[model samples]
Target: MPKRLTLTEAQQQMLDLPAELTNEPIIITKDGQPVMAAMSYEHLTSLLETLEILSDTEFAEKLRESMAQADRGETISWEDAQKQLGQ
Candidate 1:
């Protein structure tokens, strides 16, 4: 479960939390309403790397499909394709 902390408490405890616990994210609150989160650099970097890999896989599949269509002479020029797409 996500940890909760008042903004002031979060500030006070910031330096005391372990690296792993720091990365576990804390939901900061203001007047009992959630305001922000405290997350570690390691977690953020891992998330970013995961996103990059997912995007790369999607792009690679798209590139391969485009290449296959080109080989089959089923692909149009960029200008024509743009016009067809109403761009």
Candidate 2:
């Protein structure tokens, strides 16, 4: 889990961001309430990629349908797939 840092604690811990955000993000809070988060660039890029996929409704629907078909044991074999693709 990420570390929860208070405003003052976040200020004091700012220098530790390099190592702290390496493994997990930091939740920065203010006035005893959750406020924002600070994450590493790599983590942000990964999250952005996930967001991009999830945001594409058509692709997401196709993926969900494929998962449902797999759950029902409805699948195609490699040779059948190749044949279907006219390969």
Listed in order, each prediction's TM-score against the native is 0.55, 0.76
Candidate lDDT scores, in order, read 0.82, 0.92
lDDT of 2 at 20: 79
> Candidate 2, which ten residues in sequence have the lowest lDDT sum?
13-22
Regions more than 4 Å wrong, model 1: 18-23, 57-87
lDDT, candidate 1, at 7: 86
Candidate 1 lDDT, 1-87, residue by residue in tens: 889899899888877755536548878899999999777878878889877876897787887898898899997789998999999
For candidate 1, give the lDDT: 0.82
Report the C-alpha lDDT of model 2 over 1-87, residue by residue, as the tens digit: 778989899899788777879888899999978899999999999999999998999999999999999999999999999999999
TM-score of 2: 0.76
Clashing residue pairs, backbone N/CA/C < 3 A, model 2: none
The CA root-mean-square deviation of candidate 1, after full C-alpha superposition on the true structure, stands at 12.1
